[model samples]
Target: MEQRPGKREERKVTESGHRRTAVAESGSPATGARIAGLGAYRPQTVVSNEQAAADAGVAPEWIAQRVGIHERRRATGSETVVGMAVEAAREALDAAGKDANDVDVVILATCSLPTAMPNGAARVAAGLGCRAAAGFDLNAACAGFNHALAVADGLVRSAVARNVLVVGAERMTDWVSAHDRDTGPIFADGAAAALVVPAIRPGIFPVAWGGDGERADLIRIRADTGRMEMAGREVFAWAVTALTPVIRAACERAGFEPGELKGFVPHQANLRIVKALGAAVGAAGSVTATDVTHTGNTCGASVPLALHALRQRGELTAGDPVLLLGFGAGLSYAAQVVLSP
Candidate 1:
């Protein structure tokens, strides 16, 4: 796979004067309970279809024809990363009829942060007024939310936290190059949070995950690492080969077959990836929800954001068995056989 994506590599001057490489591989959890409440917050500044095309050095026709994205949310100069996370968290808590005081733990997942010092999670906690609680981060690229679920699952799984707040938030647009045609229409900014608790009965099932660092160079951003490198063709082939088996294996492990699923919510990275995964698993008629078609890829926030959109559109229903799948940088991927509210 060829590398493409540009990133303003965060640099620093250490006391010893030795430069450091800060690479992260991390963080998700689950409850059998329904979402309780779902909320998300995208930047209010909408980059119009014409505007994004002009900035990315591609025509509006190219963006819409190739990726199906007419517009995407771009963070304002004043919108801090943690600020958006807090806003999204507040929305989710409000919808659930819950408050910051009710939150037990906070997990913030992102590949890009507002600043290197605070890690975003802490500031989010401060904003939400979660006192005396620990806040940390997870960075498994796009698979972050699902991985965060695993961590939150352990919280309730081990009886450590009762109502854990797991957030997948990222400002990917900050990392995108205006001229990179492959990524300009593919990356967006947003955040999504889920309040997790231990599931009831055969509630939250197991998640099947794997990573191939060998392909870590596939989709990345950094110095000397061009903007958004992708073997779009290769990733398409890989998704068909890897995601299908992973989803099916997870289904079997959870004592169900792929055909029985009510919804298949894969990260809305691209239509090519989702449609390929669906065909591989024989999920021809199951509802396949996507917002990346319009929001582009919000990186770590992809899954939860997609689910929120599903619910908003009334596509999600009670007793629905939804399979959540994610694949991204770190060459990481995750799939969960989840039972709905």
Candidate 2:
């Protein structure tokens, strides 16, 4: 039989006054870490293919065939990154039956923050009333959510935090130029959040993360010009050839068979990339998320947003096994197996 998560275990306090136990160390704690709930915030304005195509100087059919995006959300006034994150976090906390005071840490993942001085997570914490929480930001581009999930899992396992709110929020439209065909129509805006807390059994599996700094130039934000640029074909090829192994390695670490997973949630990059990666990993018959079709590529927000969308669409159930793959700019990527909440 497969090793199940949420096996009940008694907690023990160490001399350092930290909680520790077999379940917490290896396998369960009222205080073992698991994903408790998920939530998302899609901007109100919907920009259709026609509008985007006009801006990119491409036909609506061309946009559909190329990226498979039909419409994407565009944030307008008052829909700032931190604001969206807080909204999603609130819904997650409500779904988890947790109070803002319960959260010990807040991690916001994104690369589109308008300014760098005041970390967005701090504002998110304050907005959500997590008065005593530690807050910070992470920018792994499209891989941000997966990276934040790994960090939250570890923090909960180590008893450094009882509840951690992991959020992926992005305003990619803010970074792209309207006339730039390469990125203008391909990126959008959105936010999603997950509530992670101690549990009796393990819910989050170990993460397989790696990056290629040498190829970082494949996608980058020009500091001097402050515009986003990309070689779409090169990035697509790299993703097709490179990310399959990361998926397999994550399954190996979690002891999962290809067909065992109930769902496959990858970063919502594009329909082509989503289909290719899913096929490469043999994700047939699974409810693979193609959120990019409607949400576009929300960068850091993609994976978690896709996850929340899947749950809303009833394509997943509680305690279902899911594989999450995140790959993006920085030539960075991460993959992991998780139990759907």
Candidate 3:
């Protein structure tokens, strides 16, 4: 994805109408996100793929083979996305040697909020004692985190906020149909939060985006009505066709190539989509890193969950260029190329 002077990168069909390449070093400047702070919270209950399948009348092997999910975490009766997000946000702030009071802005990225009033951001601010801070919600469904990053980037560009906290949390288990097999093994409950602040010039930078709303039904969860509507085959095909361009556009805008990326953090939607995306973008080997197989899909928390897990494995370092991509409901897609702090 070579840059065309002033143009930013985007994901869609390639210039040549075929999948392109995006390669980067793990600690390079092309893609990176400093773990300045991070945290997460899960319900006391744990649900394995087999358990979900059994309860939903689906074969465990079918779920595993199709989605590459082994298990997912579920919240207890008293837990809420707000609580999990607050806990994770506090942990991230603690890791950064700062408290929520130090946070200037809050971006609560979630698909399922505890309530409809006050927005999730306001509640999170109250919990963290950051009452003076301004916060709000920015949703992109499964790509909520990526969308939040774009929003934060714009805010930083305007110097409106210095220390921003982005939390992707969800209690998806509450929405799943206990008798529906399509969603039982896929959706999970979890939260992952991060603190994004100023870094060296090579830090978090330009991101990219892509989408085709006409196919919004590829993956959807109705509100207080029909259960999840997921076209597995449709989603897999769309991912392969749509994701390549998003990465290419983002990398080119950052003045890099698909082969220059060190690591790729795509939304943990399904193992099948992840693998298909990797293959389509020519990253079938080690260039693509993942955690979806074990964690299942945590809705809005998917990317951050992978980040949290990756950092724990000692897989990240300063100056790394990490490419984050996500696609979900709305038939939307977003990819950001941020430099690690």
Best by lDDT: 2
lDDT of each: 0.74, 0.88, 0.72
Q: Can you tell me which runs of candidate 2 are displaced by over 4 Å? A: 1-31
Q: Estimate each model's TM-score.
A: 0.85, 0.91, 0.85
- Candidate 3 structure quality by residue, lDDT tens digits, 5-84: 21222323355533221111122222223336767775567778778888888888888887888877778877788888
Stretches of candidate 3 exceeding 4 Å from the true structure: 1-35, 223-226, 283-287
lDDT of 2 by residue, 1-341 (tens): 22334444455646663344423343433434678999899999999999999999999999999999999999997999999999999999999988886777899999999999799999999999765678999999999999999999998877666688999999988889978989999999999999988765778989999998899999999989899999999999999999989999998888888788889999888999999988877867678899999999999999999999999989999888899999899999999999998
As for TM-score, the candidate ahead, 2 or 3, is 2
User: Across residues 219-310, which tens digit of lDDT does each residue of candidate 1 receive?
Assistant: 77766753566666666667778777789878887787777887888888887677767676776557887687777788888888888888
Candidate 2 TM-score to native: 0.91
**Evaluated with TM-score, which candidate comes out highest?**
2
Predictions ranked by lDDT, top down? 2, 1, 3
- For candidate 1, what is the TM-score? 0.85
For residue 152, give model 2's deviation from the true position in Å: 0.4
